[model samples]
Target: MNLVKLSELLEVSRSAVTQSVRRLIKKDLVSFEFAQDNEKKYI
Candidate 1:
């Protein structure tokens, strides 16, 4: 899922999801792929 959608579904701020995703990405728990539009998608 993407950060914006995840945030909306979770009823949280986009910044919160962004921070969490960043941590997970750094820890190698989640993988992020970028689309042409420069959105991050988690896998």
Candidate 2:
């Protein structure tokens, strides 16, 4: 999900969500597909 939506669901700041997502991306724990607007749902 987008950072804004995720932040709301998580009750956290958007910046915090952004940082967390960034870290996950770096660690290859998260990914996205712009074409399908997919989210990071690790398997």
Candidate 3:
């Protein structure tokens, strides 16, 4: 899901989700890609 959806689902701020995703990315646990509209999609 994208950061907005993830944050809404988790009831957290977008910044919080972004930070977590960043950490997960550094650990190679998660990754993200840009959509056609340039939105980031977490995978």
Global lDDT of each model? 0.83, 0.73, 0.87
1-43 in candidate 1: lDDT tens per residue?
7778899999999999989888988999998777777666755
Model 2 C-alpha lDDT versus the unseen true structure: 0.73
What is the lDDT, from 0 to 100, of the residue 35 in candidate 3?
84
Please tell me which model should have the higher lDDT, number 1 or number 3. Answer: 3
Q: Is candidate 1 or candidate 3 better by TM-score?
A: 3
* Clashing pairs in model 2, backbone N/Cα/C closer than 3 A: none
Error of 3 at 10 (Å): 0.2
Prediction 3 global C-alpha lDDT: 0.87
Please give, for residues 1-43, the per-residue lDDT of candidate 3 as tens digits: 7889999999999999999999999999998877887666756
Off by over 4 Å in 2: 35-43
Provide the global lDDT of candidate 1 against the true structure.
Answer: 0.83
Worst 10 residues of 1 by lDDT: 34-43
TM-scores for all candidates? 0.73, 0.70, 0.80
lDDT of 2 by residue, 1-43 (tens): 5667788899999889888888988999988545355654322
Highest TM-score against the true fold, candidate: 3
Cα-based RMSD of candidate 2: 4.4
Off by over 4 Å in 1: 36-43
